[model samples]
Target: MSAIARSTEPRLDSVTCASPAGLHRMAYWEWGDPDNDRVLLCVHGLTRTGRDFDLLAQALQGDYRVVCPDVVGRGRSDWLIDPAGYVVPQYVADMVALIARLAPARLDWVGTSMGGLIGLGLAGAALVSPALRPSRGRWGLDATPDVPLGRMVFNDIGPALDLDGLSRIGSYVGQDIRFASFQQAVDYVHAVSQGFGPHDDAGWAALTEHVFHEQDGQWVKHYDLRIAQPFALQTPDATTAAEALLWRAWDHLPMPALVLRGAQSDILSAETAQQMVSRNANARCVEFLGVGHAPTLRSEDQIEAVRRFLLTA
Candidate 1:
């Protein structure tokens, strides 16, 4: 099959990862040549599955081996026994294991929302000495060479987040709601995902497909409800400290970085995007008008923006 055709036919696979509680399996979808060492890892937003990057992956599969992972507690991945394990540090550890399994000579990342934070955690570690890197004692991975993170794309995310946007996200997460039918599920997803910008009926349906699954004759969200526990327990002080660390991480990145933000994004403000470019010489910013919070790569212009950068970078 052609590369574009093969992109639609992703090879489903899983990687074994560990956490403070125990070992769990994380699911991932692979596209393009399996033997290719130039790897592109595309991660989705919180509560969204790896399938969110289906379009973007399909477009770039020919140029790179695209791997999209469903972070722990979401999609086909195993849920953590301890909800606190749902944090970014744990997710970073899990990605470390996945990276070891792939052992890419060069790696590129495209992360949306929560995925961006995970990328920061891993990318930031590259600046640390190999001996000080995450070891088996931390999450069952040996201290290997620093990650080969190359060009990166942060999809509508940054170190400093707007409180109002954070509040909007927290308000809907972890709700125990079920839909009567597939149509009902689609309607609900569109209602809450307006920040993803405009899309046609099919577009919305594709976005909804992996987010909700049928269980006990009802369509419920695919993610574990407990994933929201950390957000609930996080204190304002903790959030502030975390932001400081994230900014440090942002400053440490030495690779070419692209920040794709919605012009009216509540999550990544205009000021923050500007600051990101100003703080890092290797970073640049691009905004999509009429969009808010995020510009889903499903759209042609958005996908092209990422494609052009990765190709030239």
Candidate 2:
């Protein structure tokens, strides 16, 4: 229901993979049974880490093995030597490596913001002609027969994004910010993340806890600042091209999908959510009132929606 009790902590782990530049390690946090065949992979938004799903993972750990990975440049993952490699293609490659390691019979995905784009790529590629699918050997894994997505949840993201919203996000994503104290860091998180809707003191604290680390005696956000470079270089034409590709991906998805949109969201507009469902008969959308860019699945209501959707047969 509400946030998970603080007593239950996730198991932290990492996996080695390669990028265009060289090899790097991607860290992940796991909850639930390691041997469980059902796997749920939760990926965080830009500038956020995998630990963001702590509460959601806690709620579903009993029935499924919930794994959340910090996308390459964020959290415990090693930053790439070439910042230019910080694109969705690289993120997707790393995730494929992760899936190979887990080797689940069935896989489901929950992706937020940039993470959602990766899910779209995986699900779309799995459904399309084999030639379009990302090469398994590219990531150093043998071609395991297509691991069908059991279900997918795209949190406040869709094929089409609002450029204004993206610009606003870009303003803060990779800033060189430092905090004098933990409380100060929490305050900064709250300020930038007000769109996540309201949270009690403890809930807010829990959300902020894993996002910062002590560096040179100062508290700094955990992600590599270079992660923002590619984002900063986006051109209007590039965005248009990407949107066309995403729409193609959305139309080709074969598995059931749930789209959660914040009622006040600027990132994932209501118009795009409507288009998503219209294009794919298996897709459905739910809007959370009073929330903005995204819904942090920390509340009882938010958690229940995801739990029911994920557990459905």
RMSD of each: 3.0, 3.5
TM-score of 1: 0.94
The list of candidate 1 runs beyond 4 A from truth reads: 1-5, 131-147
Model 1 RMSD in Å is 3.0
Native-to-model Cα distance after best TM-score fit, residue 134 in candidate 2, in Å: 12
Model 2 regions more than 4 Å off: 1-7, 128-147
Number of backbone-clashing residue pairs for each candidate, in the order shown: 1, 0
lDDT for each candidate structure: 0.87, 0.85
lDDT of 2 by residue, 15-127 (tens): 99898789999999998888777889999999888998988998888877899999998889999999999898788878878987786777888998888999997766655
Question: Among these predicted structures, which one has the highest TM-score?
Answer: 1
Work out the TM-score per prediction: 0.94, 0.93
Report the C-alpha lDDT of model 1 over 1-313, residue by residue, as the tens digit: 4654365778899999999899999999999888777889998898899999988989999888899999999999999988989998899888988887886777889999999989988887666746324333232235654444679999999999898998898999989999989999999989988888999999889989999999999999999999888987888899899999999999988889999999878999999999999999999998999888778898899999999999993
